[model samples]
Target: MQSDLTNMQPPCGQIQRRTFLSDLGYGATGMALSMLLNREGSGQAASTSSGAATQGPHFTPRAKSVIWIFLSGGYSQMETFDPKPELNKYGGKTYADTVYPDPFQDPRYQERARSVVQVKREHDKIMPMQVGFRKQGESGIEITDWWPHLATCVDDISFVRSMYTTDNDHAAEFQIHHGRHKLDQKQPVIGSWLSYGLGSLNQNLPEYVFLGSYTDTRVKENFSPDYLGPKYMGVEFSLDPNNPLPFGARPQTVLEKEQANQYALINELNRISSVEYPHDEKLRARINSYELAFRMQRSVPEALNLDTETKETQRLYGIDENETSSYGKRLLAARRLAERGVRFTQVYLSGYGEWDSHQKLKENHTRSCKRVDKPVAGLLKDLKRRGMLDDTVVVFCTEFGRTPAVETRGSTKMPSGRDHHPHGFTIWFAGAGVKRGYVHGATDELGFHAVESPHYVTDIHATLYHLLGLDPTRLDIPGRKRLEIDRGKPILDILS
Candidate 1:
C-alpha cells in the first residue's frame, strides 16, 4: 500500500512484485499437485488394470451362452440317471477283499472317512436305485422315476455315463469348476476362461452369472476365478431363495433422476481426471463399471420381474409351490439370462443337507430329486419352446458320483449310505450342437469305474467350448503357461 501497489496497479506495463510471486507460486503449486496426483493415480491404475481383451474361437458358435446346473456334493449315479441293475442284486455286501486298495489313506482324507456312514465294508455293495427307471422319448433314454418331467425332454439330451476324475474327496470338487485336481496351483475356472475368451455381449450384464441359494456355508475351492483375477470372476447378486440377488432396487427416497444425476457427476469428474492422466486404465474401468451398474439397475429388475410371465408359465416353473419355487425361480431366471445374451449361467441346487447321502440315501436323494426335477424339466422345455435351445447349451453335472458299495462305517449294520467315488460318474448335455437322445460311453458293471471310453472333466470342458466354437487349447494367458490337462480335446461324438 505504501509503495502504491494497490492504487497504481503496478503502472500500465509493470506487474507488482508480490502479485508476480503469488501467481508464480500458484502455478508451481498447481503443477506439482497435478503431477503428484497423476503419479499416484497411474500407480494405482497399473496395479489394478487388466490386460487387453482377447478374441474368442474362430468359427461361428452354435451356442451363444451356457447354463450349467451344478448338483453339488456328489449325486449318486445309481439313484439318478444311470440305474445299475447290478446294484439291485448285490445290495448290502462287501468288496474290501478285492485287489483294489483303499484310496483314502492320507490324513487329509480323514474328513470324508469319518463322515462316511457305511452299510458294509469296502463300500462296494451295490445299492439299488430306490427310484425306478423307464425309457423315455423316441430315443428311449433311461431316466429315473423321480424325474418324470425331465424324462419328457430326453430326446433333446445326450447322456454321458463315463466321466471320470482323479480327486476322490470334496477337494476334487474343484475339478468340476476348474478342470483340475491339485488345489495349490490355481487355474482359471471354466466360467472365467469363457468370460476371458468372450467379452460380454451385453455391456450392462456380466458375461458369467451365478444363481443359487447360499445356505450351505462349507466353502469349497471350486467356485472362484483362480488365477484369472477379479476381472474374469462371475458376479453374484443374491444367493437367497426369496431374493436371488442383492442391491437390485433403490430406495424410494433415492429417485431415479437423482441417481442419474449423481452417477453423471461422478462420471464427469472421472473423465476430467482421466484426461489429465491418460494411462489411468483403472479410472476408465471404474467409469465403465458405474455406467454398467446404472444400466444393470434397470435391466436386472426387468429380467427378474416374474409378474410379466403368464400364470401357466409361472406354474410351469413351480413359482407357486414353496419346495420347487426357489430353484424354479432360478431356472426361469437362467432362461431369461440366456435369452438376454449372458454367456455363462450357473445354477446351484439350493437347501442344505448334502446330496452326499451318508445316512439316509433313499430319503435324502428322493427329496433332493423332487426339489430339482420339475424345475429343470421346465427350464429345458421353456428353452426349446422359446426357440433358444438351438443356440443354448445346458449341462447337468455334479461334483462326482457316489461309491458303488454301501458306506457302513459309523452306523448300524445295514448299510445306509454311499461313499465318494470320483473314478466314474454321469453328466448330461443338451441343446446347441449336441446330438439329441443319445447315450455315450459306459461304466463298469458295478459302476465302479469308466471301463469304456473314460473321459476326464477337461474333456467335458473342451467339448463345451468346442460347441460354443472355442478352441480350449488355444486360450492362453501372456505370463501363465497352460498345462496339457488344460489342453483337452472336444468330445466329438456327442457333438452333432
Candidate 2:
C-alpha cells in the first residue's frame, strides 16, 4: 500500500550486479569508478583496487573533500566563537559572584555526575554577551553580530577556542558527532571513518554524503557505521536533484532503456554471486552498493544541478534568498559534493532543537544566525573561487556551549536562556592543512572553561584524520578495538 519509489531500492534480498559496466564512461566516479579514474579528477586520482597505496591516510594528503558544517541546537560560545568579553564585564555576577573557577567544582564536572543535565534552578546568572562583536578580517577576529556574512570569510578561518565535550545534555549532539560518551563506546563517525578508509574520487557518489536534519534523536550518530559495518555507513543525501537516494528513483513505468535492461540483468545475477561468495565483505559491499546505486542516477542529477549555477552563483549560495533558501540548498549541495570527489559531505544546519537557546538568548541566536550566514559565507566564497579551497576541508561545528550561567529552567524568571555548556566550546577550520587567519585555544573570563588548549572531541576526529592523509593510528578493524581516546590527537597546533 505504500511504495511509489523515490530513490534507493535494492533491499529485500540484496547482492546485485547483473551487468558489468554501463559504459558512456559513466563519469563522476561510477560504473565502478568508471573503471578507476586517472587523469587527475583528484580524490587523489584513485587507489586500492590493488596497485597498492593500501587503505589509509598512510601519508601525503592535504584534503580531498570534507565539507562537514554541523550546527544543530547548541550555538553560543559566549555568543559565537568564544567571545566572553568577561561576560559583558561581569553581567549579573555569581559563580559565587566571580573571579572564575567554579565550573561546579571541576573534577571534570565531578567525574561527569551522570553526564551533567540537572539545572532547573542553576542558571547561575551572568549571561552577558548576547551578540555584538566587531573586529572580523585582516584577522581582527571578534566575530558575531550574527555573522555579517561570516565576517567576510575572516581570512579563510581557523578558530578552535578550546572545545571540550562530555555531554552536558542534548547528548552534546552525540558528543559532537560520535567522538563517543553519549553513554560511551560508539566510534566510527568522521563520515564512517572516511567511508571505511578512503579511496574514491566520486564513482558517481556516496563515498559518504548525509546533508541535514536531526532534532537529536541521538542524531543517528551523525551517520553511524557502528562496528564499521553496513558498508561503512553515511549515505543520507537528498538535494532532490531528482530524488537523491531515498526510495531512490527509476519508475516512470520503467523504460529508461528498460531501466538499463533492468540493471543489466541484475549484474548477471550479482556476477554469479560474486564467484560463490568469495569471502563476502558484506557481499562485496552489496555489489558495490548496486553499482553505486546505478551510477547515482546519472551522477546525482549532475551534482544536484542548481541550473548549473550562476546568477552570481545563485546569489552566492543565498540561493535567491528566503531566509537563505533552506540552508542555501544545503550549502549548495555541499559544494556540489565537494567538487565531485565526495569523500565526506555532511551539512546539517538548522532544525531539530534549532540551536536550542532554551529561552531567547537574544531571539534564539538572532534567528539562527540568519538561517546560516549567507549559506556559510557562500561556502567560503564558492570554495575560494573554485580552486576548491586548497584541496577542500571546511568544518564549522556546534553542539556544546551556551550557559556561561543563566539558564533557569522551571521559571526562576529573569534568566533568558542558555544552559548546556559541556564546560567549554567553539569550533572552526577551513580548507585542507589548516591554520589561516587563525585563533586557537581559550575560554574562561566566563565562557567557563576550555580554559586554554582544551580540545577533545576526538580532537575533531584527530583533525579530520590529519587533513585526510589518514593515520588515525592505522585505521584497522578486524574484531573492532579503537580507543586511545579513539586515537584523537592531531590539533598539531592547527596544522599548516
Q: Which has the greatest lDDT?
A: 2
Error of 1 at 201 (Å): 1.7
**Model 2 C-alpha lDDT per residue in residues 114-203, reported as the tens digit of each score:** 454554434577878887788888979888778888889988888888887767777777667768776677776778677567757766
Query: How close to the true structure is residue 264 of candidate 1, measured as C-alpha lDDT?
Result: 74
409-434 per-residue lDDT for model 1 (tens digits): 77477667787777778999999999
Model 1 spans > 4 angstroms off: 1-52, 96-121, 216-222, 239-245
TM-score: model 2 vs. ground truth? 0.38
